[model samples]
Target: MKPLHLERCLRTVEADKAVLCSAARVPYYPLVVKKARGSWVEDADGNRYIDFLASAAAVNVGHCHPRVVEAVREQAEAFMSYTAVYMYHEPLVCLSEALCRITPGNFPKRVIYGLSGSDANDGAIKLARWTTGRSKIVAFQRSYHGSTYGALSLSSLSLPMRRRMGPFLPEVYHFPYPDTFRPPFSGTDEEIADYHLDLIRRAFADYIPGEEVAAVIIEPIQGDAGILVPPVSFMKGLRSLCNDHGILLIAEEVQQGFGRTGKWFGIEHFGIVPDAVILGKALGSGLPLSAIVAREDLMADWDAPAHCFTHAGNAVCCAAAYASVQVIEEEGLIARSEEMGNYLMERFRALQDSYPLIGDVRGKGLSIGVDLVKDGKTRERHGEAAAKICYQAWQKGLLLSFFSGSVLRIQPPLVITREEADRALEIIEEAMRDFLAGRISDEVLKTVKGW
Candidate 1:
């Protein structure tokens, strides 16, 4: 795990073209990770980087959390896979009950498990359609549901993920997401909400009928779309509209759920309850596990076997998820996320004061985004600068992710302490300063600006 070993790994990656090199021009960061513990990941070169990405927000409690690892180990020794066809397992039932208890809504709820966010979303779609006897679904633009066909069709982000697939599912509609950063309407928050609602009403009037629409899926905080936090009024307005129109509201919390947004469910931030909640990412503490928790009456319409996965509630994943939930509660990670998020936001705002390239800095809890722009007036994307900053931060023993072309996404593990957060802020500031100082090439700048 010396520096030489790390350089060797990077060389191998270069030779093999295995580091998603085709998508991005830059070579991947040098440091092949050896192992991770808590909030730190060690490269093969024996350098430790504070992991702000948190494995794409899947490890909220931190890497190798003792409780979660122990649960997985104990479950592994007992039994592994049990096909959903024959018998029901205790872990599955227990996890379902736990999810029902924690999810919003005082009414009785049911849970359906899956191995990934895509599968859970697929299940949610089926459940919505079956319950309403309708086929049409509405999703926001720039939102990411998953990569699979049904889920990808719901996703309206990058065209590469959906284009050429041709002939996606019918009756899927897209609406402008309430992006205040690039406001859909130039007005107050209430006006923006009303404008978006009008857009939805017009969609229903011109395209899909209100009764024909089965569900309206939304990510309370659009993650892959660059941590776009919609106005509180917008969310509440949507909820009310959905209720009045009899459209099921499906909150896709794949990236922002499970304490990532300082709440068990991001929709809770608006104090509105959704009809169905899709959860993944941090639910299993790094293991692949996802679920759709819905009202019992609504879920009852799903035809058996057709809507389930073999590993829907795999024993080990359920155990890990249970342990993860426990760790979040027992350790008070949700409160910690709020405290740390406020601290990070304060630091980020300070950065904005010093850097004109930072067009906007916003988020809730530990889920945050620092948006980069070429000139403060134009809001021209400075994605290249953002990428350079990410690379520089990697060089300085920090790891983060970029989204929405120009957003520097910071989703550190919920267990991240204030000290660790300060360190991450320092790294980000240094990277931003370096990019502003012409340390990066003009060509690179143009590349990020999408010029």
Candidate 2:
């Protein structure tokens, strides 16, 4: 088959099977990736974009970092899957130890492995309920946990994400997560903190008894719900409440972990240590791996084989994840992410001053969000404008995403240099210019709106 025809066939096959799951199918960017390295992605058709998306921060060490690839390759020479449940594996043991050592909490910690952030979170909930003997879980209104049944019940980022999905896990309650850009219920920081804090308190008082709640799961920096950074007071308040009630606090750090937040974990920025930390995305570079790092005492009671799975610690994936951590350490990418993040924020704030459509800019490290608005006064989500801007950028060979219809997610790989950052910003500025000058047409906006 011809190359173009082959690409079309692949897309058609996926489109027929995608079934409500959208993973950049069809003419989104004409990118049928041949390969990727570092922060650059090249299409089969030879188009290259400085990847600001970074596969949702999964390639923090960069796509196919040499160390991670070599680790996977070297491990493949020995074996691929030993199945952690069946026997011993050196890589798995090392990775687990690395996790226990690096994750927050001075107390002895243990690690449980999984294939995705969803299952890891589900496992965390299971452990919390089993350990605490409680059935109820507290989640946030605009938070996205994952796509699993339990996670869907917890997520409120986009209604369509859960529409007709089903009656989700019962006893999962939603409360406000403070948003500095769009304050919870539109109030001052202290007021927002107090309101959400009371909402949790009252949930235990009148709604669900505090004794019945097992865990209060949260995304330290809300990723899919438009990159919301909660007030520090709100997080401290939640920690205090959980302490008083004996409810476990689980921080879902799948997207924000692995130095994507300029720190090893997003919770570090909040100056809090969650009882358990859930991680994924960058855990194995581009490979599928995730883990739950919990206090030893917290996981000490769970019986074996209760949560054992076949591929939780696949050998090659473990090696990849281990190498990924090493790369982050040896190259000092965490500090790099922090420095680059600071520079990006400074540049973005200056651009915000020039653009009236940009309502707010906020992020930690490389995880950034730009809020688009219809106007400076109303601050209504300018979904159409965001769509236009993203399409204009895509046409100019830059890949980013907009969620909640108006928030531009600008998560570049940690390996990004100052020059690459400038190039990406130039593309964004040009796209914004197109939108402002009426060059971004209604037809282009309508065409990609559903995407």
Model 1 lDDT tens row, 311-382: 777899999999998899999999999989998988899888988989999999999999999998778888
TM-scores of all predicted structures: 0.94, 0.94
Per-candidate alpha-carbon RMSD to the true structure: 2.9, 3.1
Tens-digit lDDT string for candidate 2 (425-446): 9989998988889887787753
TM-score of 1: 0.94
- Positional deviation of residue 363's Cα in model 2 after best superposition, in angstroms: 0.8
lDDT of each model, Cα atoms only?
A: 0.84, 0.85
In angstroms, give how far residue 147 of model 2 lies from its true place. Answer: 1.1
Candidate 2 wrong stretches, greater than 4 Å: 1-28, 184-187, 446-451
Clashing pairs in 1: 384-448
The count of residue-pair clashes in candidate 1 stands at 1
Query: Model 1's lDDT to the true fold?
Result: 0.84
